[model samples]
Target chain A: MPSSSSSSAPTPAAPSKMYADDVSVVVVLLDANPFFWSSAASPLPFSSFLSHVLPFLNSVLLMNQMNQLVVIATGRNYCDYIYDSSAPTNRKTGNGKMTALSCDLVAKLEEFVVKDEKLGKGESNGAVMSSLLSGSLSMALCFIQRIFRSGTFHPHPRILCLHGSPDGPEQYVAIMNAIFSAQRSMVPIDSCYIGALNSAFLQQASYITGGVYLKPQLMDGLLQYLTTVFATDLHSRAFLQLPKSVGVDFRASCFCHKKTIDMGYICSVCISIFCKHHKKCLTCGSVFGQAQSDAASETNKRKTIRT
Target chain B: MPEVRIVARNFMDMVASLPAMKLDQLYQNAFICQAIVRSLPPLAKKYVIQMLYVEEVVPGKLIEEWVLPDGSTKYRVAIDRLVQLRIFSETFDRTSGTSYRLNPTFRVNLQKHITIGGVLPREPMSATITVRLPSLEDLEVYAHEQWECFLLQLINSAQSERMTNISPAMMRIFQRGLLTQREKDAPRLTESGFQFLLMDTNAQLWYIIREYILNSEELDIDSADLIAFLLELSFHATGEAYNMNTLDEIQRITIKDLADLGLVKLQQGRKDSWFIPTKLATNLSVSLTDSSARKEGFIVVETNFRMYAYSTSKLHCEILRLFSRIEYQLPNLIVGAITKESLYSAFENGITAEQIVSFLQQNAHPRVAERIPSVPENVTDQIRLWEADLNRVEMTPAHFYDEFPSRDVFEAACDFARECGGLLWEDSKKMRLAVKTEVHMQMREHLRGQR
Candidate 1:
């Protein structure tokens, strides 16, 4: 703000600081779990999902010309960078009405899902349980760090995770790491849960990063949920009366069984969680006496609520 | 206390004043559309994007529903700004409510930009037109060197020998317009010139650029053409030199002139010359650069009234001389003191104390910049006090009259002067009065009528 002018002052306004702002960068993390698309409970088919998401992404880019979009696909055993607008991808469709970006993002997503379906059909039952959500998140963080390193001043970067799979406890540590970094960097992770069940980790991720966590009951209205709740950037989020989750699942997954637990005994040395009290900590190998382990279980049980 | 209305005008104030066709030409260019989009408030940007794909003029009521009911004020402001920029036009009907439609050209251009990205910037330079231009770092240095020299030449005409062929018109825009030039060729700061000197570089550039745009007609170029070309330059790859031969005829001429302002750097190549858009050129349309914020002023002021400026440019030194008494100057340092006499000269030339204080605070050295208040409070207060000294007791042109006929007559005369609205001062105790010079004859005529 310019200093207040005196009585004799003749409207000396500050010259417009036209080119002194940060550009908006959006990283779209599309969850391409083949298992979820094939599931009977899922209302969004792969093609329908792509059709709706493509236009939503188009509107995101069209929202602001300076808004840079990066699409990442997280599949069963793979997380890949689908498309980045920063790189020149001029592969237009038959007609020029739609951007090569929209077409390429859809095509690449299709290829990713098909490739994942083949892999999922193979002798890998464990892959069905996970969608590489943690890996995709870490990759998004790395990409954001790369952008920041390039000296783009505080480009309003955000991550919108169109999640479909249930949270995998095996990748809990990595996901938490990504979540912490996202929190530190002030990049919100908005999660749109269209899956059958609620994802605790995704809820926590959104909550920690101050991003919206919307779980629309009707999967057919995926586009509306995304375009309305998640379309806004960090700046506009200030004024928006966004739909916020009433509660965040705060349960920790114990290291011993790698299970989400309501009550967990912590290893005194490293704070590693365990479903059952152990004399020797499973993570750090620190030994607590049998009596101490018994006492720890007693306190853990006392802390657990009946609900 | 500047008039509150003064703060209401801003950069877009001029754009709104432009003729409808001229403003339409501006929105026709994708770069201008993008630039205008970038300048909008975040909420307004959201409104534009939501309306971008809509087919027809959406009713304002329908558009208002996009945001939450609580965000109505923000929505109103966004629509208002969009209308002011001519991005959205309001349509009215006898039966229906107000509606807004995106300007057709702006809508088409902005849509095209999103679909194809930056249209390869007017076709790629031919493979045969390979020009080895200076590196980005070297180009930035060149820009600064040229810009400082240009500004220095304006301050001290003797420095013109070292400077290159500057646009005489740009020089006149700065000197002949702002400063009063005597027949002998010496220029003194006019009231506005002092204010201009105190402004930050960005404001100074805009001040001059707006003047240039206003004078674009004199240059025989359409104002819209000048605006479109300049805004399009922002889309140019900054530091990555573009072939000069690729520029259109108008751009070819404009690019060379822009080089004088350090907005673009014209490099010499063995085969053909190329132009590298500097940060200044690229940052022309949008206020979104990190470099401009951090790399502006470097001055340190002490409570003792001494000033140390960490600048090697002659431009900085000459600008300091505007309001400070220069003690001495080293290679990369200038030591100066704020004195009553120096400030009086500045105040006399229409420089305000606030401008001077802000100039110091804005340019405070890095060490002092970290402090909450960059400049010491006492110094700012003292500078303001000195300025107040000049205007505290205003001089009025009036005649003093004493020893009136009687108390009743004196009181009646005072009332008459009050009615005429020309009474400067009146002392009822001594029966002395002062009447404005213009009202002197009228009051005298009234007094004769009273007798």
Candidate 2:
């Protein structure tokens, strides 16, 4: 089977590559920065991201017969599943009620939000990456688990994400767990961080998970990037030469300061990274005594505290 | 490293055992298969849907009337593919020409797939399916390393085994029919092997999985179970871990083969736990033609007959070596030339100029891809001309029919042969016409005792 991407010309069509019908579940994560999206001249507006990426999502929907699209908004306590308001097929469910088109999807997404809020919103300034990651991943896992039970498990359902923020340092471990979940599951994560100045966490998400991570330089050309970068299903990405970031920032976030750091002291017990010179591991509560050689020179140097 | 002929032979051998045949064949005698039920193009699939509830297969001639005369070609192609693949069949009658019939199992499954809106009816029903569960960890690992190992195995096979980057278990899978081994010596590519290398990432994975499924039956596993699992895996989302509790006994057993092929990640001693279907597993059924439009970087061919690929993956480089003579490789750049010698070498290995040209155009980088003709017209023409130099003669083995009682009979048979592109050579003299196709020979039998 020819696995070339373009079929317009006389190129060998890769017949066995992944098609839209091969998709089982499609998870779409939208960046809900309404303040930024609503601003008159926001650097990266939500509407722009939507207009740029939705067509690609629609293209994906158009490709598969059994394909499903689940859109989730990630900002504050604002997790909502958006409907594909245009789908004629969706209109038939629940006796022609469009809302019924998203019944199961909305219920699952709500389960995520309710469960996270119950866990008492953590200290991440209302940016719900943890909830997004946990809820989305677990729900996906649960859904897959159920399908497998019914003798209908799809091993590689695709996840198309549109986000514009770094994952919190506190949720780094959980996020990595989610990343490993994806990696181990053989799912390639395709992500587009539109108009974000700097996002180390998402870079790692795209890179670690073997998904396409594109930062659209030309904001207006968002659709092109989405269709080109995220549109190719997991199967075809192998043969067609894809553009990947050469220099990925592989740095980790410091647990102590909750800040991204170039270098940091890792706790010997838990491997929790920290930026401060500490006598004990804050995460695991392990204490360390100063060595004699270090103590002997301690009196020789004095440190000044900045106000 | 195997001889190109041997590699090609092995690939053909493997293709013979491809599990895809069962799906095709199940529909062969039958009208449709369930997994592919929802996948039929809306129009043709709609045709099938309309015919599903009916007791009779509409007469083949009626199909022409249903579709506009201008649209007959497409309708014919679809119906022919369905028949060729055995999804639909024509039943004969003494007085009438023929009527189409849907394959029984296919008709049932397709109706279910469509009527249920593609969400399979939850009822257990008569179709038998069993469940086995996998843990979260097992699912994750299965998905991660399968394709990586498969690609690594292909790359490493081209070089020395020791220098190869793939793992041992992965290598062992290659040694078995699960992954076809390129002999460690000859190092030239055969037609099928060349085609395999040139396939998109997803198709390549299926090429390997189909190979594995071909071998699975030999290990006493039910091919249907494997197929069902594969179809299920294709629907699973990426980055999600599935519980192992849902696996069937056969499916659980199949996980070992999948893991060996790097299609699934199986944690140690976690037979009952969940396993993830890697991108390779999930994309096993994706067609290869859509890769470029959805891909970021693409192949760019210059007018001077030079080629540049903007990729760093070793697998891509290995694929390039199938045709192009590589000059140098930078961090993310590969430079190659389309020389006459390389083209001749490719042809010598049984690859056609058409395959080579199409491969180049298919993988054309987006920069060069933007142009109407990805490759310069001169370069494309040269490649074809170079191929013509090698393949100077067109040869085929066929049965020749010449004797005919009358000009009317000879002319009728000749028209049929010409329509099928089977008429090789003919002489109007001596009441004889040379017909090349044996398929028409069968038709000749039908015309017997008529005139």
Per-candidate DockQ versus the true complex? 0.21, 0.02
Cand. 2 TM to true fold: 0.44
Per-residue lDDT tens digits for candidate 2, residues B18-113, read 455565554432111533443443334434544655667678877656554656676776576556545577788877677888766666654443
What is the DockQ of the complex in model 1? 0.21
Fnat per candidate, as a fraction, reads: 0.24, 0.01
User: For each candidate, what is chain B's TM-score?
Assistant: 0.86, 0.60
Worst 10 residues of 2 chain B by lDDT: B120-129
- For model 1, the chain A TM-score is 0.85
> In candidate 1, residue A100 scores what lDDT?
60
TM-score of each: 0.80, 0.44
DockQ of 2: 0.02
TM-score of chain A of each: 0.85, 0.69
- In the range A103-123, model 2's lDDT, one tens digit per residue, is 434455456546545554565
